[model samples]
Target: MLNVKSKLQTCLLYFYFLGGTLIIEFNNDEILFLEGETGVVGIIKVAYENKMLFIATQNNEEIVQFLEKDDLIAVSNFKKDKRAIRSQAYLTREENSPLVILNKEHPSTKRLETVLSVGDRVCLNCNITPGTHPEQDVLCSCDSLSGLEISKTETGIKLNQYFDKYTIEKF
Candidate 1:
């Protein structure tokens, strides 16, 4: 009995070291990804593909891909169309739209919110303001968020919070 228990413990430890951490749980229509968004809430997956991430909620799914590792400042979801579009049909439609903001605190939930808020323009890459007192660069509307100066990249907006620096692709 002692040997059996020891072997079991060893096996479990081995799996943990091997990254067999599929710490995903599902409840009804909700799926939770552990250690998600700033350790606040778990991440719910709406869709995924090779080299891509798609998160969703009740309405839409935001699609994004990996760029450079360092350029990635944080990943959050906002319940709004961060992009502006010129469409007469959309302008004529009157609806109450609520914005959901995702941060590190609740990564999973925020990711799901972002997925559901997918549109033509979604904020992906972020950066630190870099000064005596630094702040986060806002999610830009530009196609890519990589460059030396924040203004040069696109979307001159800056966020008021710090973001997660983990690379999803590294996982």
Candidate 2:
């Protein structure tokens, strides 16, 4: 019995070690992609407790991906998407999460290009509730060399710099 218990403990420890110890921190508005994907898969919207909410684009439709901390890591020989984890829980929750389509092209692509070109930093802080048309959202101001603050609401997107606010109707 003692030998059996010892073996079980050793196995558990081995699995734990194999799981991975590297922890990743995600900031709001940060883009995440799968291992070999070039297009934007999702953007970090909120990080709470041990979970994160992503404004993800799937098949050109907007959806939400709620993932736990362990989801980001690889545990077995199975191939895993880098930032997009495919855990059992993730699969279970997929059916309940509804997909919302953005009428126009998402602004992230253009904004990212502009930011990369001018060397400006853009970040977002949002609060979203699943299954709501326009979830309660708050995008805090960004501090960058250019002092540009950009935020996206359901119907409109806003950009504010030095007290001048620019609002685009949509997209």
Candidate 3:
């Protein structure tokens, strides 16, 4: 059963890359990267004609091979639709990890918004109660936690308790 689910996910992933429409699953703390931004600077180079599109990142500077039919279509569609590129906003993770894009309307994002409104800490990776913190009570038996706290900045909504990879998803 697990194998079947994995295969299905793989098929969906392939279709998402090759099909006319794209479907993205939403996760909490995601930010949209629109066209013309430095973060999206090199996306067009790789997203051109039926070329194999790899997961693109802001730091990738490798030049891609020549384009194909699909590459032209991808560029044409992108210009025609004016769609924004979406990527996850990770509270904690390695700097070099590939960006994760998600849907803005996904249930998980909505649920996290609700959770934050009530003043609770959730694991950025698991969306469960944070492990433990000095200022916040331990809401679960999660053993790796350090802390979680609300953010005071205008640019962000929340703050992580620790700098480790297993960070708290503040807002």
Candidate 4:
């Protein structure tokens, strides 16, 4: 079964084509650098929230080939229209390793309006969870974690005022 799956994956490499933007998913765990792909396809980030996997292709030039994002492509999104580009707001993932989707009956899975700040930068590909630290809880999405750094504290989730990869200060 594993061999068949791997073979099938190798056959098809296309992942997402949202609003004219192409988001490629690597069939293999390791990324293959094709021509023009040396600096185009950024790292792939996966966040487990609400028992669903949220995937995003980052364009940040810092960690392109040097540090690639981990793979989360074995699973699929559950939504019919899973094209989560700038137009879309949410996406769901299969019950995979990093995430296990909750039933509709679950209160935590309920979708709600996300409050955004004036200059807050969020990943349009992933679902947004407002006012919470994603790493601290499984029911939260890392959409708001695009260019910001977050840390969990006894009081609450702390975020950096500015988008600094190295340092995170009080917001």
- Model 3: residue 21 alpha-carbon error in angstroms: 42
| lDDT for each residue of candidate 3 in 1-171, tens digit (9 for 90 to 100) | 011112212212111212332222212232211122111100111222343322332244332333232111101011212232211111112122222222434454333211111112222222333211221212221123223332212221233421212111111
Question: What's the TM for model 3?
Answer: 0.18
Alpha-carbon deviation at 17 in model 1, angstroms: 5.5
Cα lDDT of model 4 by residue, 1-171, tens digit: 011122223334333324533333342222221111111111112323333333221221121111112322211122211222111211222223122233334465445222111111223123433323222122222333332323222222233333212111111
Q: Which of the two candidates, 3 or 4, achieves a greater lDDT against the reference?
A: 4
Give the poorly placed runs of model 1, Cα more than 4 Å off. Answer: 1-28, 33-39, 47-171
Q: What TM-score would candidate 4 get against the native?
A: 0.19
Residue-wise C-alpha lDDT for candidate 2, range 61-147, written one tens digit per residue: 454545432222110101232223223223323333332322224553223210110001132221221122222132121222123
- C-alpha lDDT values of all predictions: 0.22, 0.24, 0.21, 0.24
Runs in model 2 lying further than 4 Å from the true structure: 1-22, 37-40, 47-171
**For candidate 1, lDDT tens digit of each residue in 27-146?**
212211111222211122222222222333233444243322112122232222222111111221112132233443444542242222222122333242111111223332122222
Give the per-residue Cα lDDT of candidate 3 at 126.
Answer: 23
TM-score of 1: 0.19
In order of appearance, the predictions have TM-scores of 0.19, 0.18, 0.18, 0.19
Give the local distance difference test score of model 2. Answer: 0.24
Q: What is candidate 3's CA lDDT for residue 118? A: 10
